[model samples]
Target: MRMCSADLNLLEKWTWNSRQNATYAGDLTSDGYMSTQQLAQAWKQKFPGLLTDNRHDYLFKFVNDQRSSTTFRAFTEGLFRAQEDTYDIAKETDEKLLRPYKFCSSWVKNVEENNDTLTQLRTFESKQEYKEMITNISLRLGFNYDIQKELVKHMYQMCRYNKAWDVSQISPWCAVFTKEDLKRLEYAEDLETYYKYGYGTPMNQQIGCTGVKDMMDFFKIHVDKDTPQQPRSSVRLATAPALLLALGALGARRDSAPLTADNYHSAVALARRWTSSTIAPFNANLAAVLYKCTPNSNLQINEQYQVLFMENEKPMNLEECRVGLCNYTFVKNRFGLIADNCNLDFCNSATKTTGLIGFTLLFVFITKLL
Candidate 1:
């Protein structure tokens, strides 16, 4: 189990206090009370590698465990000299050191792969350049796990988007994408100026970056038609164990009793829900509502299937309800907020008019009823 930084800081405090105080101060007892000295030494012995390299991270394993408080009774024994002095340590470690360290460590481990894509990517000066290179590479090789590093890089940048998205402060970003990214993007439009950074075709073209659909078209024309071998399995070697663990966590009990067919289906659905990038859990219910609301709706069987898995529906914000792939006609016909045609200008105008009219009609209807 990986340790969190919060737990690590607590362990560090205990270790510091234990070193100052007597090693074996507490009286021995049959109730299994561990002294401060005993606890630190036990942890050191248990995580020999962590103690040598990163002791705080090492101690996090014990502190994070649910049984740690019960098992390591010394932690609860209140042996620390003072709580006030140690407070600053917690605040500084997380923001100043641990987060950056974790980011850099993840980068080094992920980028050192024996591939040319990564090697060439490191030469790029800007994120836009890197993205263009990735788009070009995908055009040639078809999408595969080979582009995982680039995906990670995009994820890192996206995380920082709309905030202090400065990658220059970090070593990995400085080395890979240049060291002058501190100046935040001027606006949302600036951030999404590239078509590659946004979704779908029209926006991708308008934004002047390659869209995923372009990659799909290229793969269809160049790679998929030429491939003679069986379709490469989407499932990777690392997938099964994680899936099993997820299943176990989600309350599958194969050890106690055999899983039913329903149980298997439910588990698979859960996995799909978790893995889906476009279709959110709420979108499933939204689709169901759309299907029920629209009279003789034109939704495909697969589209309907997208919503049927959900048993209950939650309220979604207007933006949240707006999903990709599904046509606007269903929503427009039912709510009259979306335009009949899919043009952005018409859609935007109709959305505002629909909201005003819908609310005003409701007010008038209620007044008349009263």
Candidate 2:
């Protein structure tokens, strides 16, 4: 582990790669983020006038805005637009980096078939359409981040025999991965302390129960047969979504009673409360409370659960689901997941993926630079 940590020190730049979880370990393995900070700091150091937050925001907009550009109208379009089935990132990195990964032919074929599906999602007219898309993905693929979060958190809570078993989607608190530092067997106590203090606020009444290093321990036990049928749903949470899924699974066995319609509503209500009322960010524990209450065999809640999913089988917006008298069943009118669509950030919210990617990429780049 010490040797691997040294190697991460050598690599120079990277970020918490969700696709390659745990491989990076903790404490920002790469310089991607630092590069941005360094650049920001440098700019601040160079010009005091640009230090203001609003100015920085304006500068960010000006860089991307064509109206502020001196170049021709078609020039900027060509910059961001893909050319000849290749993106700018692809072209730039194609020669410099020997691309180690490529989608299999089968994956591409599936993508081709789903082109329209992607188009619908891309051109989704409203929030309702987007939420419907989320549901469709969950229903068909058994991939709802919320349900998956609930289940994984349950797993960890129920089966968390040790600190190694705790972890939910992309744990920032956990150490970055090192081939040598695969397991912190020596400093398990410190790891546990970090978790306890780092994730102080509880989601599913659990704190410091997440870390990337526990991935190995999670696969060894929680993944064995006879486990719940929907582990794959963890992909939706993106980072901690996967960890939370495992945690949800581990946490469930700790449940005092099985989730049912009578108690399930409260679980859902609690989940809503955690999400809305609490100051904490999203986590698997919150997810567990919501789905754990989902009656396992009771068809009433289960059937109603189906409606919770979109036609495509994806998850729905939790905030949109009102606790008082909101329809637990699907209500649609040509507008694609209409009832689930109203008043959502997913639809109108812009900084959905770009901001995250920008910061993460910068973090990785800076790691390399440093």
State TM-scores per candidate: 0.16, 0.17
- lDDT per residue (tens digit) for residues 245-349 in model 1: 222221211222221212223443233222212221110111111121222245443322111111112222232133322222432332222112212222222
lDDT of 2: 0.23
Clashing residue pair totals per candidate (backbone < 3 A): 2, 80
TM-score of 2: 0.17
Q: What C-alpha lDDT do the candidate models reach, one value each?
A: 0.24, 0.23
Worst 10 residues of 2 by lDDT: 355-364
Error of 2 at 135 (Å): 50
* Model 1 poorest ten-residue lDDT run: 361-370
- lDDT of candidate 2 over 1-370, digit per residue (tens): 1224443343333242453344333223223222323444443343343232221111110112221121111222232232232222111112101110011222222222335323322232224433443343234323444234234323222222112222332232222222222211112222221122212112211211221112222222222432322221111111222222223322221233322212323554234211211211221111211122244454334322221211011222333332311122322211122212322222223222211000000000111100
Model 1 TM-score, all chains together: 0.16
